[model samples]
Target: MELDCTAVIADVWLMLDGECDESTRARLQHHMDTCSPCIEAYGIEEKIKGLLSRKCGGDRAPDSLRDRLTLEIRKSVTVTRIETTEA
Candidate 1:
């Protein structure tokens, strides 16, 4: 099953969170290996996740905090989608 850039981008977060099955993860990895744009994109996301995790530390974020973060991420993704479409 070949994956396109959009498909890989859509699932990259799930793979990073270890929510993807082994097969799906393998497919994503292969795409990342072959696609320089995806590699860059995934690398940026991974770094952001890592930084957030480290800063947030061991304790779970409060529900309000999580919700707000989710909203922010959604907004950012929306903006990115618009920019990509324009480009």
Candidate 2:
């Protein structure tokens, strides 16, 4: 499939994260290789991903906290909206 700048911008995250498959990767890579704007975006995203990996990849939440969060997530939630009064 032919890709434009918008397509590359949209998929930069997938490419940077290595989430897309090889064929899609190749297509995005090819476009990035040839297109200046796509390449610039790709470079910026690459750096951001790299920085995030170095900063946050090693941190993990405590198991107790994780369990509490999991338990809370399993419970149902209810939302109620209150009407606002205006003078």
Candidate 3:
């Protein structure tokens, strides 16, 4: 049977969070057993989640840093919009 990539991505969050029922987990596992690309994608996502959790889990950000980051992001967005419009 061919596996649906859309369904797999949609269910990935549920599977990672342990919210999927046993049957759904089994089905996903069965697909992963034979699909290398999906397995690689899942691994990359898992690593990203782990890194984010470790980075932002308990660190309290300073207000000054937060404000600076917000300003930088807004500037970046404006630049991106201008570039896209010119293109």
Best by lDDT: 1
Clashes of 1: 0
Residue 21 shift from truth in candidate 3, angstroms: 0.8
Lowest-scoring 10 consecutive residues by lDDT in candidate 2? 76-85
TM per model?
0.67, 0.61, 0.59
Candidate 2: pairs in clash = none
Misplaced by over 4 Å in model 3 are: 58-87
Candidate 2's residue-wise lDDT over 1-75, tens digit each? Answer: 788666567677777767789999999988888899779877887898788778997676697985675455333
lDDT score for candidate 1 against the true structure:
0.82
lDDT of 1 by residue, 7-79 (tens): 7776777788788899999999998999999999899999988998899796676879856765676567667
- Residue 60 C-alpha lDDT in model 1: 73
**TM-score of predicted model 2?**
0.61
2 or 3: which has the higher lDDT?
3
The TM-score measured for candidate 3 stands at 0.59
Ranking of models by TM-score: 1, 2, 3
